[model samples]
Target: MKLNKAFTLIFLSFYSFSKLLAQTDETYLFPINPGNKNYLAGTMGELRSSHFHAGIDIKTGGQEGLPVYATKRGYISRIKVSTSGYGNALYMLHPDGNTSVYAHLREFSDEIAKYVRAAQYENKTYEIELFPDPYEFAFQRGDVIAKSGNTGGSTGPHLHFEIRDEQQRVLNPLHYGFDEIKDNIAPIAQRLAVRPININSRVENRFDRKDYYLSRYGVNYAINDTITAFGKIGIELLGHDKLDGAANQNGISTIEVFVNDEKYHSQIIDVMSFSLMRDIIVHYPYDIKVNKGRTYHNLYVDNGNRLNFYESKANNGYLNIEADSTYHIEIKMYDPYGNISTVTLNIKGKAPAKQIKERIDFELDRISYQVEKNILKVFTRENCEEDANKELSIYINDSIKTVLPAYFLNNVAVYLWDLHEGIPTSVLSCNKGVNISINARAIPHQATVINAENFIVNFPQSALYDTIYVSTAYEVRTQDSLEVFSIEPVTVPLKSSFYVSASPQFSHYQKDKTHVYQTDDAGNFSFVGGSWSGETIQFNHRSMGEFTLVTDDTPPVIRPATEKNYYYISDNLSGIASYTASLNGEWIMMRYEPKLRLVWIEWPEGMQNKRGNFELKVKDNAGNETIYTTKL
Candidate 1:
């Protein structure tokens, strides 16, 4: 009775604490080491000129195998081991129903280590993913689970710790409890830009058509020659600030912009959802021709980007400033620990100078022109082309038809007008490049076929190794032969299977009389040219190799494998076997989640096992069926 009462009170206390966390106004707390002695290699919310940094990086004394302890008490939930990404990661579920993740570990504790090693051996693979039940491995406060290490995407040794909600949305660790970090440094404002109100427009340099440094505290620039503007205009400023103890210039966490005391935009890095990762591009500008480089400006407008951090009322988070309007702009920047920095700007607007117009033959049109390495690509949609004339000394290459995004550009990054438009979607140069590998995964509507007659390529530079686009294009044959030719790069061998499309429509018979099939638009293909017989058939690709195909024609070969010893009186359901298909002949890992009462399959990139029919022509050594299909 006493134990029951104690358990009830504990549950009630936890429930109340959870409610408080939900109701709190603070978004995140610090999760730093107890002492603020460590320096940062990367900072949360810092501008990368490309992708957004997802989590806070705490320095680990510049070495691996640093003892890492749980930030809070919780039960072991998920443990994933991989060569890339978080190296070896661990997840602990707290009493408050939240999960704390510790990634890139050098090793696990003895108890957990043994369990994982056994699992790895059973699976016969170095990489493994598993979810343990609530009581599988529980840890109290400061219980050591793993040691921090530099693994998978880490250039140095550091601890990658994150806190996530029930739905797996990663919240900023600074919100939980780390208040020890001191950041008194102010944010440095690099440059202020006045955007032209037209799309595809150009900002005239006071002297030349190129970008020039501004003399501090100077107002109004006079174009040395003629130029024109297009579309809406904004500013791209390059700036970063240092923390109190760390010398690295880290990204600011909070941004608040006010135009004459009116809130124009505000963004706080409280939490992020993984499902919204692609939204990272939408958070920055993508127009490579105008903004010049990939520096993200937070105007907090939702461009259908579920970034999970933006909270805005009007026009997303974009602060659309008008041309020829005098205004006062104030921007407030903050770090995770309430460290603040402010920048104030006073501006006066004027029309394009007459000399600027004469030099560039300035015309306001709807077309957007992007310049890369002296090469220019003009983009014009149905209603996009308008009269806009801007003369700039840029190299022009008319050979390439497509373009890469600015992130891949050399020494240059372009910022577009919209938020989340900053990812590298196109090649940054027009140099000749090699098509490294082929991805045959099937996608809707954009499937490529092998033996294509024409290939469409958008090379970013004249020198190879820039970025190469390899896709097969089709053309008609005069003799009705339906022959498809190769359009891939010159270096890609014409007969290489990577250039081959995996679509069933492009299937052909091999010498062995087996049919080869294409997988999808992504170049994932399959071949049933040979029989599965009793042994597992393996498929090989350039990078992905040696996958044993799980044949539905044969039932899953099951042995006397059960969870625990059961003294059942000869029940028919005693030891059931199962088998699943794998794409590109890879292994499909499966398990039945007792808590959810559902069968779960990991890394299933191909067809599924059929339902209900559990008998087949062949059987394993223990008399398991050769082809046994069962419901998931």
Candidate 2:
């Protein structure tokens, strides 16, 4: 029996070593040239507006037509072409059950281009996605597959590269031999924060969290003094990583929390699914909503978040702070290259302040409205226990229409009103206008609708994921070029697209150029395409914000950035829609950077003469066109 046990120990050790060896042995050539002076504009697992950036953005010297090579011996398995999102992308599947993706390409190789063009013409559309057989377009290692460019959602000229497992989960390419990209700098912690996790809890004697700005001390970061907290509390760190010689601050690859020298929680961003991208909100939702420029990583896991990146064997990173105890806390942040930065602090738990129970008056902060079938569901945060069996007033267009009894749900008030009788002009609660209407038959589920003098909104049942009280209003801006219909308080989130129809006064010639646009809080407009049906312009949009009608008839302006090299092009009203360039009457590739309003062509190899007549043409979304010709 001792001999058997000895054998089992040896076998286990050998198996563990073998697994580590296999992981290190799995090799991949650099997708882009490692020797090139390329820097990553975006890192894997970087936090974005609505999702985590799934890939790395490899800079191409701010130019296009750089040869993109395959990382391994693989066959082109999928090809997609579109005006947005990875404009022209290719997916190559290798024998090791991993796929490499190259996106935003200027053009494919000769053979693949021929096949894709033929398929595009046959299908009669510029956007196409095809799954080719494994045997087709097989490429050996280091074969040039395509040329990188600024296409799709790219803001500049760069290649968005990705590596994925067979299950289609996006894996950080830096994990697969690309660690050769040097990064000696460590993550920098800007601030340390602690928050109360429960309603009864307090941080620094308040319900809100407290932040401590870090001061550099001896190669690491530390708070000036320890913090006093009580009850359940969570920790958060505002930090970012900097690559050597790169100006951009990127996301850290890993974060681990240690409590009294014991590993309490960890977040590893090695792989994640696109479906779980929304979980980013719950990770550090308050920070994302309040702070626009900084990223805050939450050390504790929220109850609703299902992101697989977090691992905590005990308490989900929350500390139950009890009196007469001191907890030493340490946090380690790591970059993909294993450079580590640490921050240490101490938390002294104290007994919470004594509570004095008193009679709480019922007050409503906000009212929410939703429709289910023919019943209008009204909800609000009121002290149902104190205001039990009270009557709530429902008003339509400033007139008291009915009084309904409030029902209690988990200490909150709920009221149901039947709308099968007819749609009201406007529903009111507490004498405030809560826009509510039903243009169609019974709503399938809960929804909100807004009807105004010149506009009507239909938010479908699936449009909202939570009960929302939308505040809307309209105003005409005579100072602007056209009439504007504004929707106030645009911060509300929507799950699906909602429909809006508006009647705007326009001239006969202005009709063709007029379309609905979404305006920001600062009154800047982004064109949201709409079509006219008789006198009303209707459109479907996925955001809740101010809408307006604008007519753009100005042509794009084209000027040479450099007399011999690049051109600057821009449109003041609607943005550039299409552009073409020709050298000596031969069509040349012109890479467009919409954000910078610049378009330029890389001089092809062996084209020596700089003297030539160049012609450039640009068109805006409003069909206004501009042509410029100059001698180089």
Best by lDDT: 2
lDDT tens digits, residues 1-632, model 2? 35687677667755654444345334677767754545888888777666788878887878999899888776799999866788889999776778899998988998898788667645544567999754478787788999998778888888899999989999998776575477788888888889876544556544446888887875489886878888888898888888777887787879999988999999998898988886665576444454455557889986556788888968898888877789898899988887888899999887654331322234545566654323466655554454454455665545656644333444445566655544555554444446564333313256667786688888888665444444456676667655666553344445568888887765553777877778765778797888888899999886666788878888899888855568899889778788877788866556565656777774444454656888888988777899999887
Of candidate 1, the 10-residue stretch with the lowest lDDT total is: 565-574
What would the per-residue lDDT of candidate 1 be over residues 174-227, giving only the tens digit for each residue?
655565555556665554444433333344412222332333333122222222
Q: In terms of TM-score, which candidate is strongest?
A: 2
- lDDT per model vs. reference: 0.47, 0.73
TM-score of each: 0.53, 0.67
Candidate 2 achieves a global lDDT of 0.73
User: TM-score for model 2?
Assistant: 0.67
The lDDT, on a scale of 0 to 1, for candidate 1 is: 0.47
